[model samples]
Target: MLTPDALGVATASTVKTLKVEAPAARSAGIKVKSVEELVEKLKNEAKVI
Candidate 1:
């Protein structure tokens, strides 16, 4: 009869496991009085500019 080892089939014992974690959510954001303030925050805090 054919054996599992001879067939090279992967089982739960042969598979690797990992401990994953979820990232933290961003804040609700602050209100800006003008376009300049928004740009400043995007450049300094968000760094997306």
Candidate 2:
């Protein structure tokens, strides 16, 4: 997982433009702290697994 600090460093070293789009809903702010959590969310909440 790329932490904010790591992302910052990567962006600083890159020459290409990067675009970030905000979540369309407030629930998007929900944080998944690990890959297992993310997969669980995708499977249960999103039902896309």
Candidate 3:
């Protein structure tokens, strides 16, 4: 019989890392700053004022 502990010890596969395919969907390059800067940018640059 093979147990999880025995397999982990035998194969050293206990650790894993997750990957994100689309950084753009995750908003990778969106720069943000303080509340003042955000308000200013929203008002002036993004024209959400």
Candidate 4:
């Protein structure tokens, strides 16, 4: 994961132009069959809350 300090350092050293995009207004609509499956994936796959 990129922390704020790391991001700042990277931006300071970068010479190329960086384009930031705005977030989408709507959700991507990903579907899961069950809450248990979502919890398992979060714990073992994506590893994020």
Output the number of the TM-score-best candidate. 1
Candidate 1 residue runs with Cα over 4 Å from true position: 1-26
Candidate 3, residues 1-49: lDDT per residue as tens digits? Answer: 9897867766556777787575545545566778898899989998988
Candidate 3 pairs with clashing backbones = none
TM-score of candidate 3 against the unseen true structure: 0.36
Error of 1 at 44 (Å): 0.7
Q: Give the total clashing residue pairs for model 2.
A: 0
Clash numbers, per candidate: 0, 0, 0, 0
Q: What is the lDDT of residue 33 in candidate 4?
A: 98
Clashing pairs in 2: none
RMSD for each of the candidates = 6.2, 14.6, 8.2, 12.8
RMSD of 2: 14.6
Please identify model 2 stretches exceeding 4 Å from their true place. 1-28
What TM-score, computed on C-alpha atoms, does each candidate reach?
0.42, 0.41, 0.36, 0.37
| lDDT for each residue of candidate 1 in 1-49, tens digit (9 for 90 to 100) | 9887789986547656677788899879679999999999999999999
- lDDT score, candidate 1, position 19: 75
- Can you tell me which runs of candidate 4 are displaced by over 4 Å? 1-29
lDDT per residue as tens, model 2, 9-28: 55355566688888677544
lDDT of 3: 0.77
Candidate 2 accuracy as TM-score: 0.41
